[model samples]
Target: MILITGATGHIGSVVLEQLLRKLPAHQLAALVRDEIKAAHLQAQGITIRVGDYRDPASLERAMQGISKVLLVSGGGDEDGLQQHYNVVDAAKKAGVRCLAYTSRALQNPATLTNQLMVRHFQTEDYIRASGLSYLLFRNILYMDTLPQFVGPQVFEKGIQLPAGQGRVAFALRRDMGEAIANVLADDSCQNRIFTFTGAATYSFTDVAQALSELSGRPVEYTPIEEQEFMSRLRAQGLPAVAVERITGFLTDIKNDQESTVTAELADWLGRPPTPLREGIKEIFKV
Candidate 1:
């Protein structure tokens, strides 16, 4: 049986849904913290196991009788890496043969300099040291979140950021979930690192053009200084961590770290991913 952690999350929820179409219900289980949110999944005949990465016993119990696990990386905290460690250790103790992890795409200097990326890299290192067969999914930025980073003023104020002429190969979250499901079901992905990304790369200016075409407005890409961007985001009452994570993405893009496009996602899904324009329509409902 395969257990999917973070089963109620943006990626895991869809991953579970897609996996059900291919694997039997008896062959799948979801590790979720909220039973109420997971009721629908249980109704679909999937096994629901209450667990949290911070709770090792819960993870151990969830891993019982599970042969493989998809360890979706945690978020929203500085101590998130510790939570991931708890899951990895519990999975090792549970004797899970194959463990697949969701990691960020590798940057060009192979450096984990970004605070957020550093935490993910630390988790990857710990997973490698756990001695379990593993598949490291180095996922690129999700296009679904492009609107969020573009802020609430993209139509009227255009796409403003500190990213200057940098590009990102943003894939849809649902498509990535499908690829992760395929990885969990296939043994061939074991002990491999898959760099999952969209087939095409786009700069912030290109994103502005796409928005202009979709919204029938004069959307522009405005580049600002890093401090000014942070100050503006902070003025909007966003938390420091949230500001850092959002701006970190633009910083990485500015440095040309997230521009790599790959065919692996298409290879896994047997189809082309959703185009940026289509994804924008879906997210903005325009």
Candidate 2:
């Protein structure tokens, strides 16, 4: 059976949905923390197994008789890496033959300046050391999060960030989920690392222009210093941790770390990935 962790989450839920279309219900299992959210899947005849990454015993039980497993990355600073390690150890102990993890598309996993990437790199290392066949999906930033970064303030205040002349190849979460499902269904993806990115890369200026065109309102891109960016977020009443995380992304953008464009996503999806303007329109419901 193919077991997917974080099956109720944004990406994982879409992955499970796509898998259901390709694989039989009995051949698929979902590791979900909330039985209520998973009731629909369970009703569809899928094996809904309760598991928490923080609970190794639960993972062990969930992985029983499973051949392939998708290790969805955990959230937050606390217990993120630890939970990943727990899942890796439990998967190995349960005799899972193949493992796949959703990782970030970084130039170098090692020597990460972003703490988030640090945790991901550490998990990649641990998974590699487990001696199991694995697929590391290095994904670009999600296009779905564009509005979150730009925000409603962008309509009036324009787009503000520390990034200057930096571009990002932002792919949609739904597209990434589909590509992941396709990878797991095909046996050729074993022991491979794939970097998934959008066909076109865009700078924040380009995003501002796109938003302006789509909304029929002027939007401008304003570049600020790193310190100013953090201060502004704090002034906007964001939590300290939230400010730090946002600043990390802005730092990565300013460094042009996420600007790389790849064709792997299109190849996997058998179509061109969504364009920035199109994705923005969908997000804004325009």
Candidate 3:
């Protein structure tokens, strides 16, 4: 049996749908914190195990009889690392054969602003030391994040970036989720690390052009200093720390330090990953 944690989340929900196409609903289990939010999944015939990563006993109960466990990372929480460790420990105790983890792109331990990277590294280390077969999906920044950062302005004015002319190797979350499903279905993916990204690289200006074409209106791309961009977000009542974190990621992309997209994603999915224009159209439903 395959158990998917965070089954109600964006990537997790997509992954669950794709996996259901391959495995029977009876063979699949969804570990969710809230039974109310998981009514739809249960209605679809999946085994719903109510659990939270923060609770070790809950995780232990959820992993019962599961062959593979997909440990989706928790969102920005103070105990995120410890929570993940609890899942890993429970998976070990449950004798899960494979543990698939969702991680960030960069593996370098020195990247200061790479919060996800650091947490992933710590989780991976724990998983490795557990002597269980493991698969790591070090996913690139999502094209979906573009909507979060650019959507508000796209409807009013247009998209702006602190990235200037820099290109980012952004992947759609659905594509990443599909790749994860593929990995889970295949046993050959054991002890492998996949860096997933979209089929093509795109600059901020290129994205703006795509939006302009889709909406049939002029969308402008303005490049400003990172500090200036943070100031703008601050003026809009965004929290100071949140603004800094977002802008810092933009700074990493602008420096061309995060433009590398490995071919593993396309190979695993057996097709070209989604392109930026197509992703944007899907997001805007245009």
Find the candidate with the highest lDDT and give its number. Answer: 2
Which residue segments of model 2 deviate by more than 4 Å?
none
> lDDT per prediction?
0.86, 0.89, 0.85
Clashing pairs in 1: none
Q: What's the best-to-worst order under TM-score?
A: 2, 1, 3
Error of model 2, residue 255, in angstroms: 0.9
149: Cα error in model 2, Å: 0.5
- Per-residue C-alpha lDDT of model 2 across residues 1-286, encoded as one tens digit per residue: 8998988889998998989888889999999999899998899888989999888999999999999999999888587999999999999999999999999987655544567777887888999999989999999999999888888778888988888878899889999999999999876545898999999889999999998999999999988898998998899899998888888877888777897789999999999999899999999876
Tens-digit lDDT string for candidate 1 (137-210): 99998998887788787788887799988888889999999988987777564589888998898888888888
Residue-level lDDT of model 3, residues 1-286, one tens digit each, is 8999999999999999999998889988999999999999999999999999999999999898999999998886778899999999999988888998998775354764645447778898998999999998889889988888675768567777787777778888998999899889775645988888766678888888998899888888888887788888899898866787788777777766567778988998899888889988998776
Candidate 2: give the clashing pairs.
none
Instruction: Please say which candidate is ahead in TM-score: 2 or 3.
Output: 2
Q: Which candidate leads the pack in TM-score?
A: 2
Cα-lDDT of candidate 3: 0.85
